[model samples]
Target: MDGYTTALVCAAAAAGAALVRSGKRYIDNSAVELLAAPDGVRAMIEAHCPSLVAPARARLVPPPYLPTGMLQTIYGAMVALRRDSESDIEYDRQLRTMEDGGTVSLDWFPARPSGPECAQPIAIVMSGLGGSAYEYHIRCLAKHLATKSRAGMRVAVLNYRGSGRTPLTSSTMYNGYDTSDIYDTVGYLAQSFPRAPLVCVGFSMGANLLARYLGETGDKSRIAACVTVSCPFSGETAGRAINAPGLLFDKFFQPALTGTIKRIVKRNQDIIQSGAITYDIDAIMRAKRVCDVDNALTARAYGFKDCWEYYAACSSTDFIERIRCPFLAINALDDPIALPEGLPMDQIAKNPRAAIALVAHGGHIGFFSGLSARMWHLQPVLEFLDAVLADKAE
Candidate 1:
């Protein structure tokens, strides 16, 4: 072919690639079912989180390289490596001594000044398993709320005991079943900023904890609104899915998560040796899957007979019915870790205050989209939060 013909062919190929990369992924059956939510709540969510509706274009399109749900879910696990335009958020760390002599760390992001009375709304972020305030998604949410949110929201991340490098002052460690640390942290924030309306956003395992806390506390929960992203609501199903034989689970998630368990145990070895943790630490270290770690550590740590009992206890379906606060659960149908089959849709349906945002394609906590496929969940979360606050103010 002549030089001109060759150039035209190349340009055509480039255009095709661009179209493929930037193509919109429409959500099927995208109307967000509000369950038993009131008309007002439904209207509020529809107005704010329009992306939840069906036939609407899903903001998250898997990168060309990572097209499948499993691949995207795996990508989410390594989000810390993708340093996008959102800058690393710096936080002022505060170490608080819990009632049990255990210590937890709170990382606070500076909010645009609300006033001398600290009247701004507060957003407390709870990171995923073995994650911290430094996690990429956490920073994105904090940055959005602190810099961009109309509420001028002050953001604080709760680094549970032994996670986020927080020192284990006592033999006690955090588990999916326990809500004490979060409960205490919420109380502390409430006291510190009495005038500030408190809101919460929890990711993955942290989401489960937040859900359980809301249910256990019922109407007494101080949180004005809450959002849970990629929560493994049904612990049994979620555990099985994560431990199942698969490219992502076996090669990546299992080992990575098992390693996190070992590291947590090793980091707090001095405290584990003191008592309370009755499991075989050496065996737990050799464990190949997350369930094994849960069986040996999490179940035993929380006084359960075994992992099965622990899983049953950790199930959020039992808790969702009791949650009286305005709550939203964002779940991806394609989530590999937090299996979509495990979503507490029935449980959520029972509570008028609760709703679930079911999207067709977001994998686990991965809702990455746009030309670059950067994190996309932040926008919907912000919208829901802003709506809740606005509704409350009225």
Candidate 2:
């Protein structure tokens, strides 16, 4: 079968994998509907904007699949190679560049045997939650964007404050719920690399911060173009999904954050004694259902009165309408993290400069489907970003 035919089959087979049992205790709350195709024929119509495909309202014009098992394996391997490249990231600390008295660090991307100039617009990507700049997934994306063939581009994997190899210096913590640090980091880059156009990409919670930053600052931001991949645009709807039963997401995520909070405090006895926080991190997660780990962590780390206040002020959905930057948002309906209903269609539509792309399935950044783990640039992303970069400011 041709490549096109192979993809259709994978999409159909994968559709069944996306459905979650409605009454099951685990992910009992999954809002998935497996769309059965008729013999899986190849066809295409119009597609929604990239941003719409990420959150709740994301939809793919054609379901994602492969024609045969042979194709699937081939596609899977190519992406897995890059995805696993996270193991190669090197962590380094900057002694003189300390922030808030904490050691600053970055997860360096491994350049090809030959070096490339960092002159082109570097992709500064932000990770979510207890996530590190060395996260396998984000590294996979960086590898794609910073290829030698595409050598003009470079990638900087940002760990915010506490999440990476560097120690958290200030009593304050980095949260997806806020964007001040992103602002500071971008400002530093703008000053350092004024000639290069900086493109910002954020995933999941990270995307929310990107959106919020653009909305709040409007055109004041120095970024030339932006991309938000699989961001939860609506707090209320995402909260419901986080609390969804079958996914076991809340169970898996909450405890990890809870433990990180403990570790963060345990490492600094003086901070705990200072009553710098309202409640213990574990206690907060136990008592209240947090929208995201950021919702809880930000409030505690920053001495906010409550998690609700922090989430509202920090999350981008509140300020999405205010964003005036040229931004692209990619969302998926099958995303376990960002539910379909969580997309802010009205707010996005209101922004004339924004575009949203909604795909049928890509398993929470697992858009792997091709010949034996080999991939085809994941479609629109490879093409769209290329087009975006093509129009350089002459």
Candidate 3:
């Protein structure tokens, strides 16, 4: 009834909120299961992710004394922010010419040329939604591949059309499920370095595209292996998760989408004026939800009937079973964008060449651990790649 009592009540409420947000169950190693695989791939899975093997439970221990799940996710982002600016890795930038009268930027970090001709495999890295080649995760992976002593591989990060200062010569922009750009990029890489084994690594939306591409091409794919981290298996679930009330995902994404739409609109002003396509630029820019943006801009540009249609066509859930290559798909239980419900766990469990790693708490792409904030997922990824390459050699 008095000021002191009111203040006390408010403090108690805040404490309760904190406790609720911080509370997350640790995943026991016994609960994790490796997807079904054939003899050789199964052996590789056991070697790399033993936790997935039956009776060999492996636990994902969060940093000692730190908050779990959501808190860890936020903390990892903060750590990445601090370290992302200090990257010194240089890239040779090139404009990859596309068949559709468009171009996308590629940042190439080649391995030491003097070592051996095509001795190292080439990794094509794809960035998350609204992400560029210089994104922290992309840069980290590129640097890791380039600097690893045993597997010093060349890295190429693809910047989606109209992203990262890449001009949009055509009116069309990339959507979540589009695989045309990836197809073109891989074609170019295969032709340019005929002797090098190619590997594809994608994060978030890039992962979605990569998964779809793998399923579409199946045994015809030229790449030796593929890895998808934080893929949104179901576009509907991913859209709902990002747009959920009180979450920061939409807040973080909307501004970037607005800017990208604006850039595309400005670049293709002549096309708009000539009535070649219809897009409510103002509505697209003002979109508060990711689905709305996709409907207004992405779907229209790509000729989808609507956002829902676009999401369905782009969702990997429909095609994950068709994936025929050595593949590793990783998703965190607490990832805000890629909800657990979106993953086709049962389907993956049945696929011999595909394995899914469902961690207890690696929020989206924020898989930070220990004092140095190193990405913990990279170890398994590198290990898996090594196993795949070794299997190929045999």
Off by over 4 Å in 3: 1-33, 38-40, 48-59, 64-69, 72-87, 111-119, 247-250, 256-275
By the lDDT metric, which is better: model 1 or model 3?
Answer: 1
Stretches of candidate 2 exceeding 4 Å from the true structure:
1-99, 102-104, 110-118, 148-151, 244-247, 269-297, 300-305, 371-379
State the lDDT of candidate 3 residue by residue for 1-394, as single tens digits.
8999999999999999877665434334214445555653666788755544545344455565433556665664454434453345778888877886777988888532333256578888897877777666777777776676255578888888878678776666766867999989889777777777889899988999998898899888998988898899899888777666664554555555556566666676665445467778778667777777787877887688888888777788877788888889877787877888889988786778888877776777876655555666676677677678777767
Give Cα-based local distance difference scores for all models: 0.79, 0.55, 0.73
Candidate 1 Cα deviation (angstroms), residue 377? 1.0
- Per-candidate clashes come to 4, 56, 0
Q: Candidates' TM-scores?
A: 0.88, 0.69, 0.83
**In model 3, where is the ten-residue run with the lowest total lDDT?**
24-33
User: At residue 269, what lDDT does model 3 achieve?
Assistant: 64
Candidate scoring better on lDDT of 2 and 3: 3
Q: Mark the 10 consecutive residues where model 2 has the least summed lDDT.
A: 36-45
For residues 329-389, what per-residue lDDT tens digits would candidate 1 score against the true structure? 8887878778867887788776778888766667877777655767767877888788888
Query: Whole-model lDDT for model 3 versus the true structure?
Result: 0.73
| Per-residue lDDT over 307-359 for candidate 2, one digit per residue giving the tens place of the 0 to 100 score | 56664555567677677655667665666667777777766666666666554
Off by over 4 Å in 1: 1-40, 53-59, 111-116
